[model samples]
Target chain A: DQQVKQNSPSLSVQEGRISILNCDYTNSMFDYFLWYKKYPAEGPTFLISISSIKDKNEDGRFTVFLNKSAKHLSLHIVPSQPGDSAVYFCAYRGSTLGRLYFGRGTQLTVWP
Target chain B: EAGVVQSPRYKIIEKKQPVAFWCNPISGHNTLYWYRQNLGQGPELLIRYENEEAVDDSQLPKDRFSAERLKGVDSTLKIQPAELGDSAVYLCASRLTGVADTQYFGPGTRLTVL
Candidate 1:
C-alpha cells in the first residue's frame, strides 16, 4: 500500500514563474513532512519541511504548506529558476520508527 | 566534512551471482540507513543502524540480503544469488546521533541483475 502519493508525474514552468508540487497521504498520524530535491545521478537533498502543528513553512524561495484536514501538502517555489529543475519528493516521518514514507516524486522542469 | 560515501556506483551481474556494496558514513555520525529505489518510485528503507547495531531491519529481505555496520563507521550490504527483480538503485544515508529529520545521502549504487 502506498501511504503517500504524488498524482502528477511531472510539471513544467517557465523561469521567473511559480512552481507547485502536490502530495497526499492516507495516514493521519504523520506529523512531520519534508521535501527533497534530486538531480540526475545524485542523491535527494533536503529542501524544506513543515511540522503538523504549522500550516506553512518557508525557506528562501521554497515554501511548504500542510493541511491536516485534507491529508495533503504542497511545495511552492516562487520565481522559479532554471536551476530549480529536478525531481522533487514529498516524504513524511513515521511517528514510531522515525523512518520516512515517500511519494513517487514529481519531476519539475523550469525552462528558461 | 565529507558526506556519506558509497563505493561501486554501478554493478551488473547474472541472476545467480552475488554482489556487495559498501558505504562509509560521515565522521561522528552514528546513524546509518540503507534504502532501495525502484524505477519511477521513491526509495524504501531496508535497514537502519545505530552505531554498530542494527536497530531497524523489518523491511530487509533476510533470505537473500544481509548487511553489516562493523566498528560503527563503514558498512556493507550483500545479496547472494540475486534475483532479476532485485535490480534497483541502493542508497545509503547518515545523520548525526541526535538529529531527528535530516539525512545526508550518498550517490547510491545502481544494480542490474540479468
Candidate 2:
C-alpha cells in the first residue's frame, strides 16, 4: 500500500498564475512533509516544507498547506514562472527511522 | 560545496548481467541513502547508511543485490544477474548528521536491463 499519494499526474498553468499540487497520506505517524522539484536529467531538489505543528509554510513564491485532520496537503506556487515547470514530488518524513516516503509526483508545466 | 555525485549516468545491459552504480556524497556527510525509482514512480529507499554501517536495508533484494560503503563517504551498489524488472533509476542522497531531515540527491544512474 502506498502511504503517500499524489492523485494528479500532471498540471498545467499559465505564467503569472497560481499552480496548486495536491497530495494525501494515510499514515498518521508522518510529522514532517516536504516538496521537491526535479528537472530532466537531474535529481530532486528540496522546496518548501511544513511541520505538523504548523498549518502553512511559505517561502518566496512557494507555499505549502497541511490539513492533518484530513490527511491532506498541498503546494501552491504563486505567479508561477516557466522555470518552475518540472516534476514535483511530495514526501513524508516517517517518525521512525527518519526515512522519507515519497509520492509518485506531479508534472507541472508553466506556459509563457 | 559540491553536491552528491553518481557515476555512469546511463547503463544498458542484457538480463542476467551484472551492473554496478557508484555514489560519492557531499563532504563530511555521515548519512547516505540509496533509492530506486521505477518509471512513473517515486523513489523507494533500498538502503541507508550512517557512516560506514548500514543501518537499514530491509527493502533491498539481497538475493541479487549488494551494497558497500567502505570509508563512509562513497558507496557502491551492485546487482548480479539483473532481471528485466531491475531497470530503474538509482539515486543516492546524503545528509549531515543531526541536521534537518533534508537529503541532497545525485543525478542518479539510469539502468536498463534488456
Error (Å) of candidate 2 at residue A25 is 0.7
* Candidate 2 chain A weakest lDDT stretch, 10 residues: A92-101
Where does candidate 2 stray beyond 4 Å?
A: none
Candidate 1 docks with a DockQ of 0.86
Model 1: how far residue B81 lies from native, Å:
1.1
Per-prediction TM-score, please?
A: 0.98, 0.99
TM-score of chain B of each: 0.98, 0.99
lDDT of candidate model 1 versus the reference: 0.93
What are the per-residue Cα lDDT tens digits for candidate 1 across B1-114?
888899899999999999999999989989899999999999999999999999999999999999999899999999998999999999999988776678889999999999
Off by over 4 Å in 1: none
